[model samples]
Target: MKKIIVLLLFFITTVTKSQNELGSWNIINVNMKIDSKINVFTEAQLRSLSFYNQFHYYEFKAGVSYKINPNFSVTSGIGSYNTYSEGGDFELPMKNKEIRSWFQINMKNPLQFITFEHRYRAEQRFTSNGYRNRFRYRIGATMPLNGKKIVPKSFYLSVWDELFFTDKEPYFERNRLFVGGGYEFNKKIAFQMGYIYQFDYKINDESGRDFLNIALLYNFDLTKKEEKEFTPATTD
Candidate 1:
């Protein structure tokens, strides 16, 4: 784990040194497990057009997820998304104000050395321009560097590609590709850093942008634990 982390840090540092400038995508995520099958989560994001400069977008959302089995799950969420004009920190004359709701399904498959994930989402957007519907699909893979499973104190590498679609004339809206590494601090906390490239199909302001993505994730267990063990009576 230590070696993997060192390598990942070196790679990121090299890329950052090579680039002139890159945008920043920061996220904080909190998840609570209500039981074995139910979970709730909240997330907030802040994004800048330059390295911590020209802050342009922010969002906050909350959601609930249900696990149908080991491989499949469903989630629903609602959020307020706001985008600012790109001159300074949250510049006036907001470019877009949106209230969005989405429903998504996730599927997971574990292989000998890697795990693959598939996500499909449908979104309803109430934006300043008008109301619209959008769809998205993402495929991702993760591999543990030191062990077969990504348990606590583990390091893993992940890559994903996501495509976005809308019901408009052009149909395709955006595409995003991400490559990153993560370190699990314990069963409940983790940190991830990565690079992402986003391309907009003539639809958004943030087209052809490269971002340094940083995220902190936390999980909490809310289930009750039994303190006593069951014992059987012996007849003498």
Candidate 2:
């Protein structure tokens, strides 16, 4: 459809645009399973309950930052990170709702930074016929190359491998991979995104497994601390 083409171009532009100052993630993705058995978690979760099929999915996630140090911080809050069914009759194919949380440990070097990041999630999975309960975990790293140490204008890149854990009462265990990153505008704002290329699995819509992810973080100063401003000396 025309809309799909527009969206594709939107993602392409979003990724290449360096001036995007949004303090959140805005990732665009185009995938084709890259592998078979596409949605591992969905298949396991809905193995016994039949209502969905193979299809594609798209998602978006945004959050705020809590700076612990120049190189360290904790991100908390909410964002839109969940799984929806492929082309179907029902409007509510929202089988998974991701409650986002992450802890990032950074190592600041001379011209760049290395981060060992862990993303934890509590997901609400829905069955084709009824409702179900499930959870997923993602652990990865983001490596960023800072343009300037004092006033960072742009960032290079980062990537990571993920191991997804799930207990499918209906099926078996499944795994996946998540790779992505973004550029920082300041300590309070940023723009970035990622993609999830899935492996061996099955679902009503396999496309749902291959998704685009966007992340934005905003830091609000809760505690106010006043600092003395510099005063110019005058001749007596």
- Per-residue lDDT value at 74 in model 1: 95
Measured against the true structure, the TM-scores of the candidates, in listed sequence, are 0.89, 0.45
Global lDDT scores for all candidate models: 0.78, 0.37
Tens digits of per-residue lDDT for model 2, 91-162: 355665544333323232332354454444444444343443434455455454443221234442445444
lDDT: worst 10-residue window of model 1: 227-236
Q: Which candidate number would show the highest TM-score if scored against the true structure?
A: 1
C-alpha positional error of residue 60 in candidate 2 after TM-score superposition, expressed in Å: 9.0
Candidate 1, residues 1-236, lDDT tens digits: the string is 56757476637742764544688889988887787889888999999988889999999998899989977999999999999887899998888899999999989897988889899999999999789899999998988777887777777787889999988878998998888878777777888778877888878635367888888888777776431211110000
Candidate 1 at 20: error in angstroms?
7.0
CA lDDT for candidate 2: 0.37
Superposed model 1: Cα runs more than 4 Å off: 1-20, 224-236
